[model samples]
Target: MELRLGISTCPNDTFIFMPIIHNFVDTSPFTFRVVLDDVEKLNGFAVKGILDVVKVSYGVVPKVKNKYNILKSGGALGYNCGPVVVSSGIFTVDELKGGKIAIPGENTTAFMIFKYFFGEDFDFIPMRFDKIITAVEEGKADAGILIHEGRFVYSNHGLNLLADLGELWEKKQSAPIPLGAILLTDKLKKEAKLLNNIIKSSIKFSRNNFEIVKPFVYRYTQQLDDDVIKKHIELFVNEYSLDVTPV
Candidate 1:
């Protein structure tokens, strides 16, 4: 069977998927045609039920639940790994009310968290995740929610963090903050267990053979230094990526 697999270009995704994409791990029973884009785009694909498998924001799962079932492996869920709200100048979380803010996407968990914390009173301008820091730095928006590598580099752009949405969720909930999830459509439900095992093996293979996967990681994240890229992978691809059930 040929499966359409969609994932973000973020370091964690690139790292965990390297072995599978490179055929280093056995991906028998299915051949995958991959689509790489930002997480929000993948979420959109899931919403449209265009892809057989995709990495999507956890916020989108409920909306796409009828079509997609959350997979047990290859997801991002952890503490202190949530989106941050940043601005060019110092501001409190409460002060952000009624201000224009840039978010990664409307369907992103980051945006959902922001709304949960601050409500819909503010103007939310949705843009690519990487563009959010620049949008705030340029005054295009009063503040922006930073995710993925943005969390690592926002301060370098002179952005001030007003709130850590993930921390808030952690305080309120017992479960770790679920940023993204791997979703497989109901049409493929019967094969979900097999696909989950394949994903788990891929992640284990990549970690055990880090040097072999390092080149692929660097290739997708050439703009980020080796240290940032490594940290990005470490922060996002935790035990949850291998199995989300326990998390």
Candidate 2:
């Protein structure tokens, strides 16, 4: 069966699925029709139940759980890996109250965490994740929550960190932040283990063959600095990706 797979174009997502993209692993009876977009768009695909498999923010899972089941492999969950609030100039979280804040999407984990810490005081402007930093820098937004590659490159753009929501969540919850997750539609529940092993195999293959995967990661992240791309993969892709050990 051909499964429709939706994923973000972020380096980490691309890194984990590199082998599958290149058909380096044995997908067996399952072939994937991949669709790449921003995480928020992928979340929308999950909400609509349009894709057979999709990558979505953990924050959006509650809304989609009825139609999808979380896959153990190919998820983004780790320590110190959370959304951050950034501004063009230094400002405390309290100082930015009632100001315009750019967010990747209302359904994103970044926005959910942002709302948890900052509350509903700010006027939220939802846009594609890539546009947020530029929006804040141009004074279109008072601040923004940075996720994906933005978390790593915000400093180079002269953005100041207001808070690392991941760190805060870890402090309060005492567990790693659950960022993104892979979900298989409920119809595939019986095949979850089989599909998961294929994903794990693909992840393992990518890690062992970084040189081969590097070009694929770069294809989607060409605009990012080399160092940023490296850190992006290093930080987000870990043992948890192979199988998210419950915290």
Per-candidate TM vs. native? 0.97, 0.97
Which residue pairs in model 2 clash with each other?
none
Candidate 1 global CA lDDT score: 0.89
The Cα local distance difference test for each model comes to: 0.89, 0.90
Question: Which candidate should be chosen as best, given lDDT against the real structure?
Answer: 2
lDDT of 2 at 82: 91
- Of candidate 2, the 10-residue stretch with the lowest lDDT total is 218-227
Off-target runs (Cα >4 Å) in candidate 1 are: none
Per-residue lDDT of model 2, residues 87-121, tens digit only: 97757998888889999999999899888877998
TM-score of 2: 0.97
- Model 2, CA-based lDDT: 0.90
**Which ranges of candidate 2 are over 4 A from the true structure?**
none
